[model samples]
Target: MRVVIGEDSVLLREGLVRLLNTSGFEVLAALGDAETTLTAVEEHQPDLVVIDVRMPPSFTDEGLRAALVIRRQWPSIAVLVLSQYVEEQFASELLSGNTRGVGYLLKDRVADVGEFLAALRRVAEGGTALDPEVVAQILVRRRSAPLDRLTPREQEVLALMAEGRSNSAIAGALFITDSAVGKHVNNIFAKLGLPPADNDHRRVLAVLQYLNERPK
Candidate 1:
């Protein structure tokens, strides 16, 4: 897939591009900052974008802010955000719009080339992908109210669901049958007030909404 790289650190940016290239993905552009990344996206229209959580000028959340703009401007372009740390607020913002093509993986995950590539592919295919760490953080921070209404098993299902795991995948991970997983998922949805008909993105939106509303 054609992909763009955005990171303030030149070394990490080049490293990511080289790794992606070695993994058989085309690097359309490797940019040093969010502004350049945005410009490259407009010009190249890459199939996917790999961006750092923090980028130039502010050395803060420029890449994330840029991702939001890109999502609004070019809803079809898939985005994968990599960060050294977890940012529940940013993840909530990214999926808040209920868009289908987005990923938020921790930078440490890059050590597993296969999983990283898989996440990239999933996002490009119009699926949500969030780091398991981020999910855990969100659960810990918002352990009352909406999330508290869930049973432990239901909470496990919701956590996997937030990590973008499908029914079969979650079942395999939890050592349960797909039907059992589906039942748990339905229960979680009912508790979360997420419509049974909602897809991955909408599920993400509902969960994010719940997390965002929790006391900080």
Candidate 2:
């Protein structure tokens, strides 16, 4: 996989370059600012971009805004944003559009190299990989009536789904059988009134419903 990194922190940026290099990824460029990152993307057209949510100058979402622009201009380029904390609004905005090839993880996740690499690979391969904390925030803020209809187990299943966990993964996390996970997923889809479609599409829609719903 080819990648470009955008992080203002010298230590983290160098660390990421080394990490990706050793993990079998070709690092095209390591940039410090959002503008240069965008330019690098245009120049390199990498398969994936690993960006910190904040960067140079004002240091308030410049990287995120650049990421949104990258998604707009190069939909095929996967984006994996790292943040110091859970920024629900940013995460929601990033996910509000096409959920494919997108990831939102906290910086703390980087310490777990194996898991972090898994998430990067997942996003690069056109899949979602939201941090567990990000998924939890979205679930907590969801106040839609349809969500209220879900049982506690169903809610748990949906939360794991939002985190982009497969049925077997969800079952393992919940200590349940795959059959039970499937049943709960079906129930979640039915309750959300999602029309029949690709199972992956339905899962994305279910997750979007959680993000799009407003308290009333």
Candidate 3:
């Protein structure tokens, strides 16, 4: 697969290019800044982009913002973001819409070449690969929110939604009918104050609200 890399660190950028090259991925460009990375992606239209969460200039979410733009402008390109720490907000924003072909992994995972390459391959093949820490933190944030308005069943459905389960899968997990799961999902969306919109995925918005709202 064709790949573009956006990492500010010289050693890391070169290392990633070498690793991906050896793994049979064509490294179109290994860029050091978010802008250059964006330019390269626009120029090459690579199949996948591997980016660090922080990049040159401010070094605070530049890479992430660039990734978001890429996702919006070129939805076909896969994105794999690497962060030194569990930036829950970054992960939440990146996952707020259609999450296919996305990945968020910690930088430490690079040492385990097999796992890192597996994650890259999964994302390139239009699958998700989130770090365990990222998932745990997002769940913890959701749990800390004040959600007294939702019924117990609705809360259960919402939790399953956060796990990226489809309505049918949730129904199977809860041993309920698919219709029941749909009702619970709609209820969760209503309780979260999310109205039906033509361009929005209410299910994703509901989960995002659950993750972002603070305990009242």
Q: Which candidate leads in TM-score? A: 3
Residue pairs with backbone atoms closer than 3 Å in model 2 (clashes): none
What tens-digit string does per-residue lDDT give for candidate 3 at 88-151?
6657767867788999998876678888899899999999999888899877765554567788
lDDT score at residue 103, model 2, on the 0-100 scale? 94
If scored against the real structure, what TM-score would every candidate get? 0.64, 0.66, 0.70
How many clashes does the backbone of model 1 have?
0
Scored against the true structure, residue 166 in model 2 reaches a CA lDDT of 97
Residue 133 miss distance in model 2 (angstroms): 0.9
Report, for all candidates in order, the number of backbone clashes. 0, 0, 0
Model 1 error, position 197 (Å): 20
Over 83-157, each residue of candidate 2 has an lDDT whose tens digit, in order, gives 997765556667767889999998976678998999999999999988889888766544333777989999889
Q: How far does residue 68 in candidate 3 sit from its true spot (Å)? A: 0.8
1-216: candidate 1 lDDT, tens digit per residue: 899989888788888888889887999999999999999999999989989888889788888888887887888999989888876555665765665888888887678777878888899889988888877876654443377787999888777876778889999999999999988877776566443221245567655854665457
Cα RMSD of all models vs. native, in order, equals 13.3, 13.5, 10.3
Worst 10 residues of 3 by lDDT: 190-199
lDDT against true structure, model 3: 0.86
| Lowest lDDT 10-residue stretch of candidate 2 | 191-200
